[model samples]
Target: MHLSIGEAPNGAEGGATTATRPRDAQGTNEPAEPGSPSQTIVTFADFGLDPSILKAVAELGYREPTPIQAQAIPVVMAGKDVMGAAQTGTGKTAGFALPIIHKLLPLASTSTSPARHPVRALIIAPTRELADQIHENVKAYSRHTPLRSAVVFGGVDMKPQTAALRGGVEILTATPGRLLDHVEQKSTNLSQVQILVLDEADRMLDMGFLPDIQRIINLLAAQRQSLMFSATFSPEIRKLARSFLKEPQLIEVARRNALADNVEQTVYRVDGDEAKRAAVASLIRDRALEQVIVFSNTKIGAGRLARQLQKEGLKAEAIHGDKSQQERLQTLEAFKQGEIKVLVATDVAARGLDIVELPAVINYDLPHSPEDYVHRIGRTGRAGASGMALSLMVDKDQRALADIEKLTQRKLTVEALAVTLPGRRGDSREFSADAYRGSGREKRGREGTAARRDSSPDRDRSPPARRSGSSPNRSPAKTDPFFSRPYEPAEDAGVEAAAEPAARNGLRRPARKVAALLGGKP
Candidate 1:
């Protein structure tokens, strides 16, 4: 039986209903009365969740629902589409996972007659790392339930994924690209999907997955419940919600693009790249940060920083899109297990990383977008834990810093560092920090121009050379491979050519016959 916490006036018909405006955990429409002592500690059992789910939640040591879970769980259980916006580390996954598992448990038990379970729930994430993380959570949450779950994404063997799908799973978490590949290959079926969740909607769009997302949506059952969770609700996100969600309850646990209050943010000003590197290494050593994540704007920068830190006797590893899935996973696990002291990563590779009680996060480079700054610092200060966030800033980052301050509405305290550090062996004084800070697009454009110039026909030309047996008057065949045939001297084909080798050998056909075949006068 499903739990009905609230009644929709329009009723749940055709998967459409008048959703209740989102309220705080207290179940009131107005924001929980300011200073209304933190939400009464409520257990998963009180939320009307299934016994199996309750057991799993307890095993995970979740004493109570977070503000987001408290508000979103009931709405989802009541069969309402939800648009939840909360700061990172707010336990949004459980908010939806618990209800989804509850709804699928009965169906899973009754559908045993079928050879394989039809997919009933589908969650799409933007990156492979995030997809894997969510899949792990689903497995943990549904441990006691009979429902089976699987995850699929790129950067791994498709054969294993196909095998897993053949056996069937009730819940599937996947990246957009890999999921679409499965749909096209007939390896998975989405026609029976009853619940759909788009986690990190903004990140998916940023990675150019909007069209793929729409195509996947078209393949699902028309009467399915849709839920979307994002850190911020930009105009694009709102537009996407409109197209997919049917009167989704707007739930915003925190202000848009707001940094967590528990995170103490500060900026350290340095002279240049060398100084920035020195500041990060010094801070890590001085603060005794055991497990910390350092964010860099580029993959190359991340790698260089990691190696440089290692040379300074700190254990560090770099992860980015260029790394294989296995390598990325191994590095993440090592970091979590305290085997690696520091994990350096680019923005795209670090999304959806669920590290518990990560003590600190360092931003080696300020992100171009202010929203990204929020996400970076969010890696720390999760689950009511206190954490520190530090950013290494130079003069070039002034504009980006200003944008961040404007978005968060708070000025970050900047401390100047005057210490000097050893420069790279091959570093030249002529190289400016701005040279390394160019956007990826500009670098690609310059490389493309150089490639075109190098491949030009004129640049590839070599002085003509006479062949050993050919006459000096004879022109060489055109070297352009795209031409239908080699160029020939037109005069040699006229009537005067009748006196050539073929005529001398008495093997030429009569000109009148050729003319008749060609339908021309002789």
Candidate 2:
């Protein structure tokens, strides 16, 4: 049985709405805090979007604008650049996409000619998954319109992407790297682009895409509408905005690194790295968590955690950068379809993944960046749905927890977790540092060495002990008698033997030659 160290509050129900207020210097409006009732009610119909676009919105069952969407849509539709900061899973795509589609509808072409498309709108995302997600949303939003949309990113064959680009698309979603690849190949032109969006702009900077971003900017038309959206606006992001965006309105629905109120945060204090795996297994097993996404700090750690969970009789799989595009997509699909119980992933899946009604998320390792903590848990508790965020924290995690608290502007509840893993013998206190590292062969080698004898100088210089395959005493193999006999010399006068050979050959020898050659007195 598993017991929660800290009893978390079941977050209050009821949705919050955003309304327009006086703009500040950055063109930002403060919405009411979560759970604080607002007198004004806002809806998508108020945005004056085309009837066809409204049809798609109605079909998708979206009623009102999220806080970010409410603040961003009006400013974007007014033909002004915007810099927005909102937590992940906050309908950030719809905030920008709806307006972009609305603005581009007038230019939408019924003709199938390539010149009519001219790449009118471009949305650049940091990861392939995010790009695909944005493309899907844009496609859904613009279904009734004559606008054509497509996505391109690295991984898989570029031939298909090239063909799509050459054919023409009005709305394009692409990653920085692959977009630059298309630029180099001259497969797509960005000159006629009227609107540009940098989704997850901070993540792009973190991934060192500044140079690629600059190159793409150079290719775009000078006069264009641009929007930048991310969870946090770092100094670099601000600098990027200053360089490109002109009099851009700022839209921040939440504070920097602010977590969703709907996710009940809890941390399980594990004894050490060895206990972390057991703790995760115990929590999932005890809670009977049928679906959960466990976050790992590294790709290797994600793979190892997935394996450990599977060994404990859980259906789990890992998705990370090391995986192929198809592999990650398939794994995500399996997890989404309820075929897999657990999905262990790295920060790659932290942003732009829209998993509807995700019940919970577990942190197998605390993130290095405080900002990442927000995105990691943002996968759940989306759209006012209650969810759980559990993290396994060892002694070293205190500093990270502090960073998270400082960024989120709140303290997190951490409680001790006593884990009892099945199919393993002995106390967890006995796990040596090497026991949890690398392959099993290395640990077994150390155990074998300790089993032989205690450390001593004699052991250092002695020959290696025989392995289990060797026998201490055994009969030697038989040998031939003739080969074993001792050497015997024939007693022929050395000079006479040499003289007989020379005489038989009818050859004359120098007087002292034979003696000198034989090492005799000359």
Top lDDT prediction, candidate number: 1
Candidate 1, clashing residue pairs?
none
Residue lDDT tens for model 2, 1-522: 111111111221122223243233343444644532232436677778889988998888787666666667777888888888765666678888998999988898899898888799999999988898789888989999999998999987999999998888999999999999998999899999999999999889988999999999999999999999877778889999999999887776664555668788998875454467877888898887888989999999898888888888999999999899999888877877889899998887645766777788999999999878878887777656788999987657789999998887898987656665332234232333333335756664664455333323565365668889888675668974445655545644644554675577878665553465666675
State which candidate has the highest TM-score.
Answer: 2
The estimated TM-scores of all candidates read 0.74, 0.76
Clashes of each: 0, 0
Candidate 1's C-alpha runs over 4 A off are: 1-41, 110-116, 423-522
Worst 10 residues of 2 by lDDT: 1-10
The residue-by-residue lDDT of candidate 1 on 437-476, one tens digit each, is: 3464575356446545544678657747967887877766
Q: How accurate locally is residue 282 in candidate 1, as Cα lDDT from 0 to 100?
A: 84
Q: CA lDDT of each candidate?
A: 0.78, 0.76
